[model samples]
Target chain A: MALNTGNKIPLYQQIKQNLKQRVKMGVYNEGSSLPSLRVLSKEFGVSPGLVQQAIYGLESEGLLAVQHGKGVRVLEKKSSESVAISFGFIQPYVEYMTFEGQIIHYAEKVFDRRNNFMIPKSSEGMASREREIVEHFVQNGVKGIILWPIDNDPNGEFFQNMSHRIPVVLVDRMVDGADLPSVVLDTHEAGCDVARHILGKLNCRRLLVLMDNLVISTNRDLIQGLSEQASEMGRMMDLTVMHLPITDFIQRLNVGDYSQVNMYIELVERQIREGGYDCIFCPQEEFLESVIIEPDMDKKFPELKLASMTGPMLTRSRKYNEFGVIRWVWDFPQMISSAADILQQWVLRRKRPTENVSIQIKQWQSTE
Target chain B: MALNTGNKIPLYQQIKQNLKQRVKMGVYNEGSSLPSLRVLSKEFGVSPGLVQQAIYGLESEGLLAVQHGKGVRVLEKKSSESVAISFGFIQPYVEYMTFEGQIIHYAEKVFDRRNNFMIPKSSEGMASREREIVEHFVQNGVKGIILWPIDNDPNGEFFQNMSHRIPVVLVDRMVDGADLPSVVLDTHEAGCDVARHILGKLNCRRLLVLMDNLVISTNRDLIQGLSEQASEMGRMMDLTVMHLPITDFIQRLNVGDYSQVNMYIELVERQIREGGYDCIFCPQEEFLESVIIEPDMDKKFPELKLASMTGPMLTRSRKYNEFGVIRWVWDFPQMISSAADILQQWVLRRKRPTENVSIQIKQWQSTE
Candidate 1:
């Protein structure tokens, strides 16, 4: 099968998986030099830069080596002392979904150390394309899969049935009805924490919670947590919930097109003005830094303390408090590493996939 | 090693582990007859009933068989195909600490199905004894260990360095300063849930939470959760904390001699009368069912409603509401199964142990 340009996975990862498979299948022998970069790039219908990146990844992993002025050559194989535990890595684009990309980065490092291999596949955030890739992996005997499932699918039921065939571990967000193992930040808990900090610490009562959509489990949980906190405080009658048109946007916001930023901004601004809201809470990490609520732009809404769930790199260097927001930071590395651990157990013929885990989120401290 | 009667592990389990080791080491060849029950009982210094139970356990796992006239015979061994993932199971006595024993039962069944094995060990509730068993297993090349760490240990630091030498998964309770993987019920969340249920559902303003000890993570989390809820509602001054004498009693209450339970009962009764508390919350599952606040005995305090975290069997067959108590039923099976999953990942030459997980607890429903 040829590479598809519209795939969400980076071009380099796609090529890397293709070449890795051929090497494992014995189509490419040990010590054999691969075709020149120009020839290989042309064959896969990609630029030479992408092919070189793929080759570099292989070289770094000890799968292949690049001698000075020589083509990439296959290295000696690590024998599977037992059956080599293998998994298919499904991800969105690295540039847009940096949190997920970083997780995959750590997972690959861990897999190498464990003497295991993972092949990545992407369909440009298209659920149908992902389904096809999963089918291909299953038919070809890939043992298990680690999926960063896209929330853009209208049906959202494709993943519900995917895990039935092989062990499928989702990262970052849980699907509503799927019995799949997932490693994710507890948005529900984050919501409760944010509510406490804003209401108790900042002395803010009228709060506005912003999220792309409720279909996403993380987004839905955020609302649930916030509502529960208010109800517990005997303030449910005082809680305000604002919704975006499409569901699952909090999860797939980066992958899907959302050109109407001003519309969401205007809606937020209107709610703050009319409701006399003292705080703005957004559990979606992507939206915290996105244009709709940009840092400098937050100055427009004076006296409004902002709250959000943050990724490791998002608020690390920034003076977040001065930007009028406090973050409940999530450990991205933990989510990725945990998913890999779960996949390893299941693929190695363990009886059943483990229960889904919701990682605890911590209030951001200056030390981190 | 001679079997000790003081072990927390059942005598049958101890003997089962002993015989299993001999079989694996070829001390007893495949199709060979094990020593007669009379000889084995005398040699191990155990009762004949215990020896029979041990042999029966082995037979059920396809490791041995009983013959009509001949002695109990060894059966053909199932090849491990891969490294037979092994863990030493350390637990409390099965008779009183029934919840933990049920967890072990399910874990053993999972181990059998996964083609793995676990040896059982216990020092009752003796911390020093537990340390010796852990040291012995570490030296014997056991791949991993699952410990239901006793809270009675003044220095929980014994478990501190255990995972450094090998993977150690703590079940139910987490040691204070130990860098180990653990699967436990989130007592802190249970604290919050209880606070909400008591304050909102029952509309009770004064709540008294009674537990054997605070060093127990569940009990500590319960207090933390309750205080946080009151604080979140801007009522920190109203939150009450009552401390017991022992630090780790919640964890080892059943094992340690707690004949002074009447002192605890008197304190609770006095507090209820003087403080005018309408509700009593106990996160300790064992205490919820034990005599500190007996079901029929609770009638003396006519207006007080009780709450506790429960195991699967504790409240299942009983009429809970009529007893003047509500339960936050915890899924022990989920806790055990999740720990099994975590252990499986660490023992198979994986790079790092996964993060500690706290299983979610749900409120009891009539349907369950």
Candidate 2:
């Protein structure tokens, strides 16, 4: 189509648009040189300067590359099309709002302004749905993907197949037997550190650890750490371990499900009465919170000191902090920033690193 | 340059090489379309078919892209330049030979034929040297990197900065606070499983865990798992944990350094006599082997039952098998394949995955 000079749009912009359309239509394919500026100017009934301006505009937009004495060339078709990176997480958006927010914050800072971030709606235990979301991103031209996968994900083969086509960064939990990059907390060490704090620093003679049937690596790591440290302390320490019968309480707690809280309280109370423990440790903040919130439960077990691994929600809560629970805070900002940094390399520079990054654990104790 | 008909090379090949040289010398810049077939044929005094063939050759080599209506265009000036992906690990080549071999095997299968793999010489605790190697790779335009980092890496900041330029996959170990992808064994679960086997199945009443102060996540995970499981089984089990004072002995052992083996044997002998343990758990295969190789140590402590995390080297050993040590085997093929799968996704597709991939632990109990 010919450029209309009488139109309000600038002459250069009109010419640029016309050329862009031709490139999109494959009239001038990628790496295909455009007609010389003189020929274009004569054909468009515009000045040679206007033609030059149009080419320069396209060049600035990354649709065309101008090489001196080599004529203008099409670099890419549909250059202005926004290619967003998609992130898939097992947790629903509302539950992982803080994490989601941090991802966007760091992604914006790292990615080019032209790029955007997309998060598909996902829920716990929806491995099939997670695979579908990933497939959808792959089908579309998503630049990259970040996934916070479900525990014991059954879609390992699907991810392995997808890995052949894109970069996938696992954020929190990882799938066993799926070789994917990840940014995670050193929960095992954190567990050991927490044990050291309780048994070494606090010097409680009798200790009780509360866990659930989630069978996650993090929980295992934490429990293992506490056990090893206690074991190392030998006859000086007496450790009792109890598994919470409440399945998926951590996931439920994230979404504000507290119907099972009473069940947890009763279980903890029974264990305390039987074991006569002086110190109690919960691998997750949600578990600790559930126990402490059981009105008069903390007072009834006044001799018991409590500690747990904290999340952003628990760390920020004034009421939760007031309970005087010792907590381990994960460095979320650093993790997000690190993920962004890795993304910058993979997406922009196209460099694939051969190492996993771990976010260090920060312990938060009541100053009072 | 004029074509030489007398040369042994085909006319089209000669033309392709000449054109390639010209492109390399900047006669035709990237994004610069070449002359029409007719013009090129006329200029070179060659048949139009020969010119067409030469252009197709360049196109196939990714140096040029030829459009149907448009002329041949330079796609990449240095298209034939080989870009190798570099892998850096803290362990020496001979020490981690099987692991290294597995990595290479899987990488070749997953990567494109055009890509090559490079592994620079590295040794344990050489964090500064590792950083320099990474820098060298970046400067050289290495496509991707695989890192088996040292524990408590001092170069976390450097690697994080490098990750902004490329995708990194951490193998076996990870750096805390660096956002990178990884493929690792779930050592924590293995620890728990081993503990269960020993306490429940084998009915070992007393346990001794012998470890070195390498301070790796695997050691911590194993120790934690063992401790937790032992604690859970309580009263029914007695556990003792000891750390060997030897530093880098694990690395040295892998490469066949037995100078410290005598020291280890002496230490174990002292512990066995003092503690009178019936079952001994070595966190690593090397440690187990070191203890078992001490002529008649098993006979000296007749009731001692041994167990360890086995690698390819140890598992294949007839003598090791004869020792009847219960072994936990990491599926190297699966781990490597998973890593390769992750690398393919990150490097080729540029898709960032959001979760970590853990290699499943396989148990190999002695039939005897």
Candidate 3:
């Protein structure tokens, strides 16, 4: 844990709180238009998105009336002047897509704060929105923001090129080329763990790894880590890697009805039967359903098994009864807290934490 | 189709038509912070989310620089800008947890937009961050947004409140209080269609309708529609409704992998053994998988047949060669376009669209 610099908090948050305190003291009347996201972001020298995230947080909390373009107007005085805290993701909760469930679980467990905290919907591939949604909290006067940047760029040009100007803790993804604090699972180790599990426990000869074509940094690292581990296991273990182009497949699924059998499903099943891949690894929850739901797949591909690299348990909804495919649960809270520590350092203008944050993907072995 | 008010045409489009316009202008002038989302939203009187969505679209196009806590800054001069548009949802794209193969097929089709029109990844539950992600596009200067608001609001307060600020259209869910444009299939008719097909075509008598819980408004509509149509078929039809609590099931599975085999997988197998329901109507993809994937489902539940409401073509997948699930493809584009129309009226300060935009959910009977 690091000290909270007064300015380390997001600009919008700083402004909103400043205004909120004034309101508590009767400095500004209620029903008044607050400073715009731009004005506040500029005053605090932070991205407008953080400001927007802060404001939206306040709006959701009923402290702000966002009359569309009319600007954010203070609705009612805070019963107390303490600013609320919030966090957000650019992507939807993991449950909706592949890995994680609703984001609220991870949020509740991590922040564990007394003030109102929020988890924003994850945006699909809209990197810029990732920044803005966080700012929404700042504008409405949130105390801090916890964000999950895209995994690919641990410290990329975006956050590095610009100053965060707020207390932001990065979770899940790393910001490449920058020292801003972040926390993420050791995907490389997770991949290594899965590979070791398959080669060691499963006693499988030919293993095939199937995944989406795009090398999302997280998945890529997992692949690399797995490949490395498999190699280290020596000639006794022979493995082949197949990168299936599932991007189009995912897109089609998004547009089409949720009620029919499609080609990709057929292909994976075919792979399991014809390709003779001993074990299948699916990174997302969506894929898990397909494997387990197939009627007696154990009979169809008796040699094949399933595994997954998943987010925290909080992301998984109550409906996931059978954990047939997922061999492990990558607890997101531990890593998220670590990432928050790094972000807090950046906000406080402290020298970046020297500790190298790494993750180990754990696996639950098949008892059978 | 309706006049392309905020289509994907970029601001620099004229440069393609006239090359002379390029070099003569410095355009954005380096380091100039682009107008913040609030400024743009206020200028256009659109919701900040719409603005942010547009801004993200533009940022993706390299038209803007989004700095954290600062307003959007112009990275380089732009020849043209993408206009902003607002959109809504009409139909739900549901998926079964076990049907991975079908998901791939659908993903491919929807995302094949010639590398344009990015749909943000969504988690299961609607996170609070949805608004800010949309606001990013507006700030970046995207031309429009097509959104599927969360389906949980039965009263449609989400769309009703947001429609006032932008050009929004409704998708799968429709509301009476808001005159939002919509594209939808008559779920009731679809249910009726299923009833007719199962009883009239398949000649099945006893039926069990396995539906997801009523968190989604469509779940309620679907149940109501199916009940009405089943009743119309008279005494020949014996209908028993069973709601599958998916949330509970997913959690158990996430915590322990064996929950699937011990709980859901076994329960499904047992249901087949009792053989009370000759036909099953699974309203979502998840339910469809649960009914069909048990190890001995085909053997024990020879009389059991299923009509799946949503999809990922689990049957078409290799796991089940005789996938008896009925398929339905939704008209997502039309639904999105209609929602855009409603949002447009709001953005332009015109009269709200008429409230009678009722959509009949469409169903495509599977030949397989």
**DockQ ranking of the models:** 3, 2, 1
lDDT of 2 by residue, A1-368 (tens): 23433323366765765576456545688888998988888877789999898788778878899999888878997673322233322332332223443333333333323233332334435887687666554443343566767777787777776765666777666777777777878887887787788888998767888777678787787778778877777823478777875447755554444567777778778888887787888756656755554244777877678877654433222234456777788765566556555643454333455547888787864433
Worst 10 residues of 2 chain B by lDDT: B83-92
- lDDT by residue (A55-112, candidate 3, tens digit) is 7877776777788968988788754344333333343333234333234334433432
Q: Between candidates 1 and 3, which one is better according to lDDT?
A: 1
TM-score for all models, in order of appearance: 0.36, 0.39, 0.51
For model 3, the stretches where C-alpha displacement exceeds 4 angstroms are A1-159, A164-179, A191-308, A312-326, A332-356, A364-368, B1-186, B200-278, B292-296, B300-304, B311-322, B328-344, B347-356, B365-368
- Please give, for residues B1-368, the per-residue lDDT of candidate 1 as tens digits: 24434323356765776676556546688998988889888877788888998888788878898886888888865421222335666765432333433454455545544545455554567778688767766644455678887765543676775665666788888777777788998878877877777776677768777655436566667788888987776656545677664424433443333455556566667887788877777655445444434434467766777777665543221223236468787776677777877776664424356678998888876442
lDDT of 3: 0.51
Q: For model 1, what is the C-alpha lDDT against the true structure?
A: 0.64
- Per lDDT, the best of the predicted structures is 1
Instruction: Write candidate 2's Cα lDDT for B62-168 as tens digits.
Output: 89998888777788976533322333222323323334433333333343232323323343347775775565444433445677777677667777777656567
Q: Report the CAPRI category for model 1.
A: incorrect
Fraction of the native A-B contacts that model 2 recovers: 0.00
Q: Which residue runs does candidate 2 get wrong by more than 4 Å? A: A1-115, A235-237, A246-263, A315-319, A365-368, B1-368
Top-TM-score candidate index: 3
